[model samples]
Target: MKRLSVSLSAIALIAAIPLLGGTPVLASLQKAGESIVQTLTRPQVKLNLGAEKQVVAQDQSGKEQVSWKSLEGNAVVQPGNILRYTVSSENAGDVPAKNLTVTQPIPQQMAYVLGSATNSNGAKMTYSIDNGKNFVENPTIQVKLANGKVETRPAPAEAYTHVRWRFGKSIDPTTGVKAAYEVKVK
Candidate 1:
């Protein structure tokens, strides 16, 4: 009877081992599933300006290396003239980029021109009338009428101080991206 009781106890302990071990594994699997769901639902956007390729003198290794590329233009900008800079972005992750927005801070001594934005993807570009603060589709302006009534005025190109590009679909994962525009100096 003593030997039989010992054998029963050993069998019970062995069965308990699997249940105890499975708890951690199950917890880990649940955590992994939650992480995947978060990654899929989270909004992510990646920005990249195109690389510059230039010729450089050969080194002692007899191999030519690409030279430094500047983000700005090589030429100097005169006052009251436009200096264009391109800002590009791509959705490099597995999820799609929703409600895409691009903000370009106006440089000092520069004023934004109205309706000058040219989007590579037509109908995907929008202009912001209120600096870079807010964006809308076909944003309009409000005017006060002489009769104490409010009137709506179509926002002209000049009111457009910022350019925004809204993509209809998410950019492909891990793709080269770029967006550029011209800014005038006051």
Candidate 2:
């Protein structure tokens, strides 16, 4: 009878060992899964308009590499003059970034000169006639004529300005990106 009791006790202890060890492991796995889910669903984006500063450029490359000092001479003026500004973006994440878009609010003092924006990667540029309400490629005013009557229509607000660029490709790892354009300030 004593031997029988010892054997039964050993079997109970062996079974209990796995039960004890598995509870902690299962709990750890559950926590890890929750953490991964939270991370995947979170948004990772940082946007800010650089400080209002002046930029000046003497050459194309210098213009491309915009700086506060480079814009010293560029200002809004009447006809026969042009002003330029640069907008920059950065991939501040660990993974590759795709479909990168940069937007700049058209300063009230300037008007976007159609077809003035240039991109290094041949990106498609668009314009918004309204205050960023809508965007369209090759935006133009529509004219309706009926019985010798004509009506003019403007584009939505989300239209492109002189400095819109869509980096259709991925910005690798961690790097800063920039886009610039010349605008006529009225």
Candidate 3:
């Protein structure tokens, strides 16, 4: 009789789900679900490289004006041509994501454009010259002259190996973030 009463009580508790007022029986299950969701917060990131082609077209005023068309995907490029690299990150999970950092490697055959990197999400930007071994606001290297004099000089865009973006705030759920920079083909 006691076992039967205990079984009935368990069944009653399991069936007692209220939409307006939650009961103590569902608290454990609710917390477990929340913890699992928080632990599974995943962020998706993607990168794209493109070039802008100028087209001469007549405006409404009948004057020839230059307009740009973005060319993406595998396309033939030439030296001294400008290209844009964009990095996009999004929160694909139900929870917020923190400390999102996106890194891009500047191809050896290309030179990064100085003062062209910008962040739309207000992320902190840094550069690396030692193959991404170290990152800083401005990278420098020690130069040795013929007289054995050592001097530290700022690294040029051609010397840049990588670019990094450290997000300043947490990325909210379903929020999309983008950052981009320009470079020139060698």
Candidate 4:
């Protein structure tokens, strides 16, 4: 999945925006033994992203098991293969980073697996069908019925263009979170 790499640094910068308030500002002063000093700082979050291919193995009894193989270092990806992408973030600063959101764009020629997105940090997940322009918890589309009436229905997996996870709680110092989703190569 080398070809499917995302700009994780860019995402980290975006996640830091809310805390930076457009630019770094003087935060507060700390009193230490009759001395007061002003400290300017912001949350520093380290972000990482990786891709893996799902493998299904069968035993002699025909029992199926699932596993993932890292897609790094020249791994070959082919059509109809199922791939899982994981995004991880850790706060390395003293301050807690609030309102952290991670958005990952679906790689071209891949179809999302519905309901496959998961977050370990208890985040509110959303989907985008218009190339990340807009996102909703459940994306729907208008469909025309045989009776010439229009109906609203859940969007198809192929229509999914991006996945986003927004965390309600602040990420404390030295703590981390993870989010993952699956997609099928088209």
Candidate 5:
């Protein structure tokens, strides 16, 4: 009778696997769903740099006017020319992307234009002067004085190392946000 009781308990425990909703099969199914979601919902970002061009435009006045144009594709830039760098972020997934942030390094041998950074789609912009080690709305640096004292001053345009944009809201699927900043080639 004791052996029969032990056998019945073992059978009952085996039957409880599915009934308790804690079986390995259910766990694997949950993992599969998570994998599908992760694979389906991902953010895609595209970055580009363009040079500004001065174009001559002729209107009905029979006179030519100089206009600024953005040379976007395969642009050729020279020293002392202004270049605009843009970042476009799009959510390719079926769901919204949360906490979307885009960062771009300042091109070497270039100087960032003060207050030229702009953000679309309700984003916040920040600057970093320490090779992306830190970010702030107005980046500054510490200068050590000869008297053994340090003073913080506004960072120069040439000191900018990176720019970042942080989105406050979620980015909807198939929707994109654009951010840009201007820099002068050294």
Candidate 6:
């Protein structure tokens, strides 16, 4: 049917943040002793992203089963429909990539599913409620109590504006890492 152009430039932006590190590797130059040549070796990560729509069905036993259909093709979704977004990354460079991070923004018309964010690389997960400027493990909001007192409480799912995952370890060359999260159409 129809092909959608889904861009994931955020991954590239995050990957490039750690470019300045050790000195470049030395290479052979002309005349074998004239001058030393420097070659920059760094991690070049590639990312692939996909979106799927969740479908629920009942079998003969009347048990509910969930299935996902790729959103790459012509797909129509209604309000309250669940959609899962997955991003896969692989390093193709000579050196390992350190402190890998991925941030995903929640659509204005969608509500994030709490506890639905997952990473295959054992990353530290954080949430952002104010666009993407700030992030915390659990975003909180101050609510005024009945007695003219204000208390801080965990922000609701609808308040989630972004989700971020930070990997503690370095990703080796050709290693694949995946992250996913679910959101519901508002």
Q: Model 5, residue 20: what's the lDDT?
A: 68
- Top model number, lDDT: 4
Residue-level error in angstroms, candidate 5, position 62: 15
Runs off by more than 4 Å, candidate 2 = 1-69, 72-81, 144-163
TM-scores, all models, native as reference: 0.54, 0.53, 0.68, 0.78, 0.71, 0.78
Query: Candidate 1: where are CA atoms >4 Å away?
Result: 1-25, 33-45, 49-76, 90-99, 131-133, 144-150, 156-161, 174-177
lDDT of the candidates, in the order given: 0.64, 0.61, 0.80, 0.90, 0.82, 0.88
Q: Where does candidate 5 have its weakest 10-residue lDDT segment? A: 45-54
Model 6 off-target regions past 4 Å? 1-40
| Residue lDDT tens for model 4, 1-186 | 553455776678789887777333324222342242213346788999999999999989999999999987988988999999999999998789899999999988999999999999899999999999999999999999999999999999999999999999999989989999999999
Question: Which regions of candidate 4 fall more than 4 Å away from where they truly are?
Answer: 1-40
Q: Which model, 3 or 5, shows the larger lDDT?
A: 5
Clashing pairs in 3: none
Error of 6 at 129 (Å): 0.1
Q: For candidate 5, write residues 1-186 as lDDT tens digits.
A: 999999999999999877668768788898999998887766544344445654557989889986667786686777877777667766766778788888888988889999988888878899999999999999888999999999999999999999999998988878878898888889
True lDDT of residue 69, candidate 1 = 42
Clashes of each: 8, 15, 0, 0, 0, 0
Tens-digit lDDT track of model 3 for 68-159: 56876776778877777777766776767778888899989999999888887899999998999999998888999999999999888899
Q: Write model 2 residue lDDT over 88-181, tens digit each, in one string.
A: 6566666667787776667666666555566555566766666566666756665668777666566433243434567787765556566666
Q: What is the lDDT of residue 37 in candidate 3?
A: 76
- Supply candidate 3's per-residue lDDT for 88: 72
Model 5 stretches with alpha carbons more than 4 Å out: 1-22, 41-74, 145-149
